[model samples]
Target: MRWIAHIIVNAVLLLALAGYFQSIHLSGIGAALVASFLLSVLNIVVKPVLILLTLPVTVLTFGLFLFVINAITLWLTSWLMGDLFTIDGFGAALFASLAISLFHMVIDAISNND
Candidate 1:
């Protein structure tokens, strides 16, 4: 239900990112969907541990280090997806994470209004 909608939205956002950046490459909608699912799983499982382990750095950076954590997650997603979904470099991964975050915020806000 809600999770399906979120995954679809994330897939759409991934496609949008591919269109927006030359460095971001998505093989197709299928790859985007797989990447989206993997990203969500990583966020749920790996992100918490990462946030806990990096609490000091995150606190020192005033929570900004979360962005780096997100970028790492994105990079991991790309690595896991291999050729299916590829981000050129750390810069591309960072930018893609920011774009995805912004899109997710907007989507969540819109959904919450309904």
Candidate 2:
């Protein structure tokens, strides 16, 4: 239930970001949905390993390096999504990741759920 809501929100966010940022291009809401799901899967399967592998950098940066990891996950999602979803470059990915993370933080804070 929560996951579904999260995915839907992420899709909406992706669409909004694409509209606001010239660097992002999403085919449509369907593409956004697919990209959102892909992101969720990668976060589950890849993000933790990335976190582990980059732990030293993460600690050194006072946890800020997690943003780069998030950007990498977004980049991977765009790569896997092919033409349907695209980010112009790593800078765009970083911006999108930061926006997504901020939105999620606010949502979690409001809902008081993990």
Candidate 3:
């Protein structure tokens, strides 16, 4: 199902983030899985709300503010899933978001279309 693919992609993204960013800590596959779930939820809910609230700044910055939105989601996921995962600081969160986004892009490319 699409939802399964969704979760798998998110898990892979989280794994890639953990590998790429030293400040992100995932104890094991289990922790990465849990972190992926929280990150997906944060992306689905919190990200849109933050984007809407920061629309003016986002527009002014030519969409660069989306990076901040993404970082906030990373930080939020870290906070909500602290028992399972950990991120050092805003800089780490920012890099994690970037790494995750890039990983997601690669996964999406390889998945079956439509």
TM-score of each: 0.94, 0.97, 0.84
Writing each residue's lDDT as its tens digit, candidate 2 over 1-114 gives 999999999999999999999999999999999999999999999999999999999999999999999999999999999999999999999999999999999998989964
- Give a tens-digit lDDT track for model 3, residues 1-114: 887677777777677777877888777787777777777788788888899999999999999788878988878878887756788999988877677677767877877464
User: Candidate 2, TM-score vs. the true structure?
Assistant: 0.97
Residue-level error in angstroms, candidate 3, position 110: 4.3
Give the number of the best model, judged by lDDT. 2
The ten-residue window of minimal lDDT in model 3 covers: 105-114
Better of 1 and 2 by lDDT: 2
> Deviation in angstroms for 24 in model 1?
0.6
Clashing pairs for model 3 are none
lDDT at 33, model 3: 73
Highest-scoring model, TM-score: 2
